[model samples]
Target: MKLHELPDELHDLVHYSLKGGSEDFPEMRQFLGVTVRGDANLIWNKYKKLAKHEDKTAWREWVAQRKDSTAARREADEKRELLETRRRQIEERLLEAGWEAADLKFKPWSDGIQQWHELVEMPKQPRPLTDRVWKNLYAKLKPLLETNREERIEREYIKRKIRRRDWLEGVLYKLKRTEPPPLLKVKPRQSNSETLSSVFRSVTKRDVFPFVHDALKLPLIQQMNEDDIGIEEFREGIKEHQSKVEDFITDWQDKTRVYLVNLIQEEDREYSEILQPPKNMDLDAFARLSDDQKLLLRADSLFYVDTACFRTLMVDQPYDYGTALQTAYPSLPEYQPYDLGTEPVYEPEAPDLTVIHRYATAQEVARDLLEDLGKPNASFVEVNQLHYSCQRCHDKSARDWTSMLEHYINHKQIQAKVDKHASLLAEEGIVYRNVHDRSFSNDRPMIKPARRSSALGARVPVKMCKLCERKPIDLNVTLSIPRLEKHLLEVHNVNDPKPEVHYSLTLASMFGPSPGSDYEIEEPDEDNEEVEADNAPEEVPVEYYWPESSELEDEGEEEWAESDLQ
Candidate 1:
């Protein structure tokens, strides 16, 4: 039981505390002294034996916990106070607004007082007013608003639609630049301690490259050493391989961006003048985000914010908001979306009852067609929610709109089915219901087609390659959807079609009659295996031993001479 005769792990802890310049150790000396006492040892040994513990691991863990708790407790207390303060403030707002208790159900952001996540989590979480919490509040407000002042609710809704129309008009003018219709509203992911209790909670921080980062920090990677292993070439190989990787990544990124621009552009041509990305991306945000650009979207972006807060004292009064809004803005200030250019003039046409949307995906086109077929009540599903298995990839959710579109299109036999469906719906007397319908007919995309750098060349060519676009050579690369998709996933690390990813999509087909037969897509397991194999080579650099440039012409002659000599 002598302290000196204690186990090395225990003795070392004491030794580091007492002998080394680790810290002033009077308490540590006492902490070490008690371990050897017969009376103390009896209880400790019994606890260890009963617990079936063999080593000082338990004691080590206790010391670690003690250290963490000492510092963390105070911080936790301060944070809890702040949270409680915010909670109270929210509660006060709720009381003032006369909200029901059920309307403001909050998921406890912190467990009691102590939070280990603040220290352990890479990106810390913001607790107050998360999107889910806000939505909960909004949901409650919506019911109240509808009940108390239905007219105001409807009026505000109209105003939003009008505002949105103005925004789209701005996009075509290029006076106020435009952004493509968001496929999914994305938000920055928030860090959370995983739990089985299912509750919708808004994320304040999410790791975009969690798997990549974890793999990079593995112990095996940390152990790599050129001098110790006598493999100096290993380090060189890593550096060389990384260089090739960076180059490949750059090329893939450029290709992905161009592909997106092209896709969205096609959408404008097919439907109406739609939003396109700014030709010159202000790289300030891109540089700041780096790989995390995908995860940097706002938390509230999950759902489109259809309602704007009109926080006038007039709104607080028990009066119709619609009347109040109209009264406040009287003439509405002669609103126009663009100030830089005069609005273009074009002759209007009669409303086409055949609900044709120039959407960038098969799902959208299908949805529009379905709506035209008197199925307008179909709810919009979020990108994160759609989980249908893809038969072409032979894998579940390669996680891109293109992959989703490929699966959707393949089943329907693209081009042929589109016309057939339209005709089918038309025969059934299904009137079109456009999502972008507004108060005035002027809300529709302009009659004048949007101007683009490639004016006449903006058409989708036949037999397109989705993966690689060879402008003049392979103009119609996207027509081969399966081939292009396979190549994109295998070569580029691009998987999901996120808002952050500068990519676009458009459906193309020679619409006429339903063909005699469906387009037979060959599903070969071998092709998938080959593509997967090719993807493996991306991790390593390709090394080619090249002969001198001067010797290039004589190399074939030299080989022949050597063969003759042999």
Candidate 2:
């Protein structure tokens, strides 16, 4: 007999017998008076599945027959009547509000990601009649509904959207290129300055060449000239091209200024060696000037903006000086006229002052030691990397600049050593030697991961959340420090989020949007407004939004609204 022909009561016994040893199957076969098949477990499994399915089917049929009785059928009929009545009321209200039944239906969760799976399934079970649900439905549908004039306007908008998308894709195509930027690909002999002036005429554009030049630096450029840049490095630089370019430029500018301050501190180098007279000036006249006059000239080079060129344009033609100036350089705060002898002296920039005050005595002492050691151009990078041993303390242990500075302070033999540490003179008792010359290899300073000075304070705008990582969610969102903090507080219920603890210090030197970018958020204007009625009801039945109870439970924690993510 077939497995299905076996009595339902004997099915469990046959299954257990078949599931056991091969010898037990013969007894099962004798009882059923049928051949025991090869692979008894497989036969038993197939039989069990079919039996379970039949049992379920019979149970459903039994339920249906039970419902055919008076009480359950009447209750179901009443619910159906109520649901139909509610549906009619909703349709009437939507029609009164100038919307169709189709317009009031549920839409995809994200319009941008219009996949079939993203399509929202409307509830099969009737929702409870409530004011909140109706209000929410109305609020959601009201903006989508359109009059004839509004529909025409919407037609125009569709064209604009298509055009905008095409334009955006084109821009992205240029940005996504692995080859060097058009600005960086100019001929070798052509001056970067000239290239910057010609191609990057706009204030935003002009900075690009200098930024790329400085960041890649002279050695890399020379290497690239000999044989083009490595594809991997080139790809890295060009990835998220605009953001990387901007970051490079900002960093280069800051480092250049800091280097300039360091240059100013070098006693070994004379002003005459570093500063040159303007191209228009005669060398003999510049040489004849005193040190103070040369200093003044240096200051003028920084602070002086020539208004004479604009004045000539104003005098020669029908040009407004202010308008011309504004057009040429929109970045300038204001324009000031100066006589030939009255050119303004250069005042040090605020950033320069900030750098100067940052380490104070440590900086000055570090500079003196570097100058004395004949490594005046040595940066903090080298200072931290190389090993130093204190000659005064007679300690053979290696230390980096930070520890060396602290050690020097202790030798001051003063109270509040920590507070006044940086104030100590380097000439006092902190003579040091490069530990690379030392005998013990193990005594060399261990390399620590580089950390930015606290003074710099969130230079890179892009940040990643540790909380999100712990939750194992995507950190691809373009959030800055402040936004990351906001996300932590709002989404994770994390109070007083700190950057170092809750987010990474690692710079995103890869393909991603710039910090604070919300390019993913296409419907900015429509979603920005806070409509109280449009929100999901606080205590609405889960069946309305989520079909499954499991889904409803996950909705609170996992389901992020697109606007909130942005």
Candidate 3:
């Protein structure tokens, strides 16, 4: 009988039997729900005839395919059973080793990788984690981690990912050259990395990529390549990574010690170096250090750091750092004015800046001199106690220097007014008043002469915080320049650590308004006086004005703000 002409149940059995060249009449009868209704010899004979007559070669081929498939399944089952046995063996060993239960359990039981599948947790220590730890752990765990079972079979036919980056790098190199290379391992990794890079690029809008190809290039590996590359390309030329890995048994060490160090440590040892204070570095030595070093080392931590800036108004000619043309050479014996034919032995080394100031003091005369000096286009400025002078016009000015630079600020001809007042003081036989006199303030101390041993020598004015009123306005408080400076730095971040000192630079930074300064010198502007008055505490006294006695309308008679005539 033809196969289809038989009953549907018998026909299905025959087809199934033909698929593998095997017959089970009892199972066929059971499938047909006729097991209780006895014999099936007739149907069984029909199945054999269909198999033999229809195609003998096809039947043999099916039988061979079936045997191969059965053998594969049997082998797979044996491998799984063996792996389970091996994993159990490792578990017994590790449990006997007394590792924490929590740690022994690697994955979260569901989502992540299982405990037995991975090596131990790396870095297993407190911070500042270095290559030292990695090397040590790798040595201790090398034998336990590499198992034969895992090596034999591949999940998705790809080897386990951990501890194999370096091996993959080598394998990938070979794979690239090999036509139709093992793609199960290579293609997915490259595609995934490329996809990830595209996502990162899209999100960050950056041109950075995570991978070079199937192999991810780590910074440490790149570094290794840079340092070890020679005339010949050799196997595993990345020696830094190779040396760092403790295991030589497995050719697949990840070579990621340096990468881990960067991730875990606050400061990366390979790529960064922090400056420690030198025991005895000189000012010149510190000055000669590079500007990048200066920024990192903090200029204040070193000696008095400032730049001797050279400026030129010749716009067509760009400035050169090496040019010494505009340097202010000190007056020597050759520059002495002649008393007779010979120079005076006691002639001052440089002309006094007080004499220059006296000349520049007059509004009309100073204006004429400034115009004559060609608008004073360029000045070679030094960064010490910056003193002003009109060299071309007056050649005379005070050598009088003070670190308190607030005296330089003026607007609306205020400097001319101050100059006229000083000139008027001269008429009253009170000459040579110091530029930064501060005795007039009830809070300020008498301007005392400072000797070499004095603690009060060379002090600069610091920005005062308006909100800082925790202490009284006394010497130990805001009046203490250093204390005020510290407060400004720590609390407000309003002071510059290494402010560039220029002669014409405004002292508003020290006194009141500066760029990004929140504090304003409180004054009775009729418009906003009530607003300030409302904010003021009833028990506290308002602040005294920062102006000098000369600037005050009615307080000019005290004469106490004059020079320290010691």
The best candidate by lDDT is 2
Sequence-dependent TM-score of model 2 = 0.24
Per-residue alpha-carbon lDDT of candidate 2 for residues 1-566, written as tens digits (9 for 90 to 100): 44445554333333222222243355454344332454445544654565577457764554344335524544565566666677677668777876654444332332322321121123355566578878865564454443322433333333332222222233333332322221111111122122222242111101111212133333433343334323233333344355655455556545544443443444344532333432233455445544432332221111112243545431121111112222233231111212112353221212222211122334444444454444444323223333345442223334445455544433322323322442332323221222222232343331222221113223345556664443122223345555565556644456676665666654434565444332221111111111011111122111111112222121224221111100
Q: What tens digits encode model 3's per-residue C-alpha lDDT throughout 498-542?
A: 333100122344664443322222211111110000111122222
Report the CA-based lDDT of candidate 2 relative to the real structure: 0.35
RMSD values, in order shown: 35.2, 27.1, 34.5
- Candidates sorted by TM-score, best first: 2, 1, 3
Query: What is the descending lDDT order?
Result: 2, 1, 3
* Candidate achieving higher TM-score, 1 or 2: 2
**Alpha-carbon local distance difference test for all models:** 0.30, 0.35, 0.28
Indicate whether candidate 1 or candidate 3 has the larger lDDT.
1
TM-score for every candidate vs. truth?
0.18, 0.24, 0.16
Model 1, 524-565: lDDT tens digits are 111111000010111222222212231222212321111110
Q: Give the lDDT of residue 170 in candidate 1.
A: 26
Top TM-score model? 2
For model 2, give the 10-residue run with minimal summed lDDT: 522-531
